[model samples]
Target: MNSILRITVCAYLLSGCTFANSEAMPYKSWRLGFSAPNYMEVWIESADVVDIKEQVYPRAMSGTAAIQTPLNNTGDPRGWPEKPGIGKGKNVTGADLPKKIYVRWQSLVEPQTYQMVINVPESTRAIMRKEEKAFCAFDGKWITDYRNALVINLAPGGMAKIWVMGSCLPAIEVTKVKAVVDPRGPYEGKSGGKYDKLSDQSKAYVEKFGVPYDSWK
Candidate 1:
């Protein structure tokens, strides 16, 4: 009788007219774990962007969740039944590992010649090229442990999106995807002026591509 009463009370408490989805709340930023000295960081802007960000974790979930069990019948000690994880251990959260940074390589003027060194699978290079790419500190670093990558150049004022991929479930393996923009062709340096002000021509490009005029300029 006591057990029945406890279950009934629990059910009553849980039965509600509505429940809030914490994820649906407006999130300005999300924190993800990276190995010390090699952590990844990303800042989110809108709800639609958040939804896309959410997809990365699920892709890495299994890799993070699979913990190794002791052999020789010591009895399977899977923490997951008691405590589910976004990846390998009980501590893991639904955060994507080896974070990705996507930027809009909008053009400020009529598209000009540009160079990039994106770390993408050969398959994704064409899509990346169509988008404007930018220079990054770690672009084109040889990846000893990955397969399939490509690099390409794009037009001036064009845009390219780039990001990394990985899983940190077991503390075992992590991965990353790369798309980089390298400076190629001739680039002339101009002196400081009212550079903050966007040219009328560049402003239209920024509006059309949803990128910041100043950043692209």
Candidate 2:
């Protein structure tokens, strides 16, 4: 092969190409945290291709395993089995970030689907660039578990507060978006037993499985 052709092949391989000519970037797996008066459908845009959590639910501010389940990187999706070819994930830099995360909800009286987009903050992406800097305190020492996190905190009157769950870098509010409230009103529910309200089967899984840091559980 010519010198230029050989160099081109090397560059492609180094870029973390999975499918020929396809662009796959490495993303610090981040999970979705849901907190609202009523249950709403939520998903990360393009989550499947990026190895992110798609189907998910975890209390946003419980401060427990609700958002702290996977404290160890040893079980991370990209390297969980401790075996090669099992975790097929690319390692892209921060330049490939800014996943277009979207949230939508509708319940009870407020049957109209309310939608909004929460863009990833440059601050969080900056942290992902430096894995050493992103961290979370578990037991005693710090760990880089919750690096690429995204949060949704909904309130009455169609208000939403999005946050970057950077843990050690300290969680930061990324943006806030408000939708027009329906004439009926927001969905009303009790927070005291949010988990208890779930079906018996779901609650059982919650007790055993924790929503991981990298992908949405």
Candidate 3:
């Protein structure tokens, strides 16, 4: 009778384990924080594109047309992890940066969407177009990849305050701006490498046994 009871208990526990593992996991969303704005009712992102880019230069020479291409070094579809071309600029020594402050919204959905609201100074607003691309330079160099540019179209003026909203996270702010154009995606660079393969569960086996705990009378 004791042996039969032990077998019944083992079956019950195994069924519970299978049921728990079969349930699907729920999806969750998160919001990453940036600097706060000085004003309220600032229009946030309703929808926008998240662009990424990278450099693809096979070789570099001392005197020749500098080659630049959109590419990524990492094999992951997310785009290149680093942009090396932007570091070739004169270093700044405690330079005061212009205040073009804004807040970028980072919500993780299926495709992962982003939106930003930037308050451009009145002086730079007059020239701001309906669709403008601004090169996002970080630290010192022009970010050539995932650290690419933020495509924002601001109202142009000398001192008129305008709110610029768009999709995609902004480049690291400390980096200054150099050029402007439409934002692009990560460049698909070299593609000739093998990736790690996943293992099959069928090839592995586990020992199955029965053990009894005795506390019942």
Candidate 4:
């Protein structure tokens, strides 16, 4: 082959190899799920890494940006519960009740698990244990192994299908479940300052599952 043609072919082959290597790298993927009573907002932020931007759910807080459960039968075509009392064999309809919310994200560079933190609005009244089952799609199949994931519970007042958040938790050796409640009102302490005033157990929950500062403001 001519010199120029040989060089061009070699360059193309090198580029192809590079692309293949990039594609083969197992990019990190994450899924986060949680349930709460009342309007709940979630934020995922990096603690060790300064460059990684914090992630916010619902994108915006106004209008339809808030993460919430279905409003009615028309709102939930999947037949998920739209109100509380499903466990008691009773049906109740309302906007303010326990609601489930889930968020997911993936990245080419696997995030440092220990540096990750979760933040919620200070308005959160209580964190309830999720009694229902949750699932996620992996390799085009649904995975229901809760033991392999982190679970956070909150008592938001609404009803909807199981849509829980999943993601990495820092320093978590095994799958962990955490529950927490805000002791103050939405306007209390100007952000999550109230987190510092929580009881020892509640404070430990914030340390383990939540970011150091409030992300709501």
The TM-score between candidate 2 and the true structure equals 0.40
Q: Across residues 1-217, which tens digit of lDDT does each residue of candidate 3 receive?
A: 1232234334534553221121111112111112111110011222111101111111110111111222221111121113212211121112111122222221111111122223223233222212334354444434222212222211101011122222222323222222121122111111232212211210121011111111100
TM-scores, all candidates, are 0.17, 0.40, 0.16, 0.20
lDDT against the true structure, per candidate, is: 0.23, 0.36, 0.20, 0.23
lDDT of 2 by residue, 1-217 (tens): 2232234334633666342222232353444555432122122111111212112121112221121113222222211121111111122222244433434343212234244445444455555445544434555666654345555554433456655554455555566767443233222222321222333433343345532223211
Model 4 is weakest, by summed lDDT over 10 consecutive residues, at: 106-115
Residue by residue across 46-121, what tens digits does model 4's lDDT show?
1110001222123111111122433221221122223322110111111122222222211101111111123322
- Of models 1 and 3, which has the larger lDDT? 1
Candidate 2 vs candidate 4: the lDDT winner is 2
TM-score of 3: 0.16
lDDT of 2 at 204: 42
lDDT of 4 at 206: 35
Clash count, candidate 1: 21
How far residue 94's Cα lies from its native spot in candidate 3, in Å, is 41
